[model samples]
Target: MTSTHRPDLPQLMIDEAVRAALLEDWGRAGDITSQATLPAAARASAVIAARKPGVLAGAGFAESAFRLTDASLQFEPIMRDGDRLSPGDVVARIEGPARALLSAERVALNFLGHLSGIATATSSFADLIAHTKADIVCTRKTTPGLRAFEKYAVKCGGGANHRFGLDDAILIKDNHIAVAGGVVPAIEAAKAFAGHLVKIEVEVDTLDQLKEALTAGPDVVMLDNMQPDQLAQAVEIAGGKVLLEASGGIELDTVRAVAESGVDLISSGWITHSAPVLDLGLDIEIA
Candidate 1:
């Protein structure tokens, strides 16, 4: 993770997402409570703070929510996306029209909490395998419409992204094997269809399939649901000719063993799909 250089989430990328979220929250009525109670001229200062300790992500998204809600709002960062947080640590400071701040609060925190959750979870898995050559990567099993955002969060938490979508790389899964009639044929089809720049990966469930996959000269082999010993054996069988990825039911306790088994990458869907939301809130002060 590069701390000094924060990852770039361009305005174009964030604007659409943040705008949609804000629109969802606003609906037809548009923060009726704020409109009914607070004067349009009201102004205040607030701080986005951590309610629990975790790694941070989504600084850009959170900022986008606030600014897009009301252009005059001043959002300043005290902490970057990849920074570690403790309870009471302020993530950012905002000063703006009170009603605009209030209206944008939930959308901003939602992005922060959810993305930070993924980042924190990825960090946990990354910590265990740091000593090994393996890297923790996220699967494409991400929340709909939020794949790019979630994958970016994975990077913030010190994990790598597998593929943004099916278009980037060709991963021939077991179903693909069944469709193509066999492992060799699936690999053959993928190789024939893939362009020169695209890498081909095949998912194999057993050592026998691993043997078959290697003959087709795949760039990577996903050893799905295999035990650590089996993975070690597969690594030996490949003889470093193909990159090995151990994926399936990888949790914190077993990740180290998988890493030690000499696989090059460890991927899981849990980090993106099921990670608990990081607790964060905005503390406001009226001006």
Candidate 2:
């Protein structure tokens, strides 16, 4: 088994939510097919293996699903979060009642596969910028309630995380700029209104606004929708006066170019919002 410690606090809450979701999925009688076809006393053991190469994540959550279904279930993780695996690599091992395993299989695989996918995608972006000082980060475009888990997966994949919510950091976007009249006014208002502890960041779509944002001296500046040449120019203009973040139009193909532009951080919303779920399965080994 992997020696990495399980995430106690967040994992416990995730377990409770997974259990509730499983309960909702399987009501009074539980999985009807397994109950009808499999004997109650039947025992099974199985291995969770990767069918493709990717980073591992959420193994604990998958184990939680099985344990929540049957406390007697024994789960041994073969890999830790952030561990890169190849096709046919075993991720985890499970031994438990056949019915319990069958009932929990989908929920378990769902969490594991979804999170692993996010981690894999995030890792790709991180790897692209490995040579640069820029850090790959995820934005607030997450799957609602699953943000915490997804962000955790991003970290596991070697990426940094942006603010968790609106409360943590002050981000002044275009709409806020429009409401406040312009970039300078928005940043000025933010600087005046924000607490001393809060770091204020403003998004700019053009070099003119970038110039204005720099004058306001916000903690961070987000360069939105700027081309690679424009980004390099913006970075040069900023001259390390404040942290520069590159956002918008980031994809697997174009990300490396963006990272090479000398920005401090590269934030992509698609890694969490649009990444496809990894293909994984839990097959029973009758014993």
Clashes of each: 0, 0
Candidate 2 clash pair list: none
Write down the lDDT of every candidate, Cα atoms only: 0.93, 0.87
Where is model 2 more than 4 Å wrong at Cα? 1-9
RMSD of each: 1.7, 3.1
Return model 1's CA RMSD, one decimal.
1.7
Model 2 backbone overlap count: 0
Highest lDDT: give the candidate number.
1
Compute each candidate's TM-score over C-alphas.
0.96, 0.95
So what's the TM-score on candidate 2? 0.95
Give the per-residue lDDT digits (tens) of candidate 1, residues 73-173: 99999999899999999999999899999999999999999999999999999989989989999999999999999988998998888988989999999
Best candidate, TM-score-wise? 1
Q: What is residue 110's positional error in candidate 1, in angstroms? A: 0.5
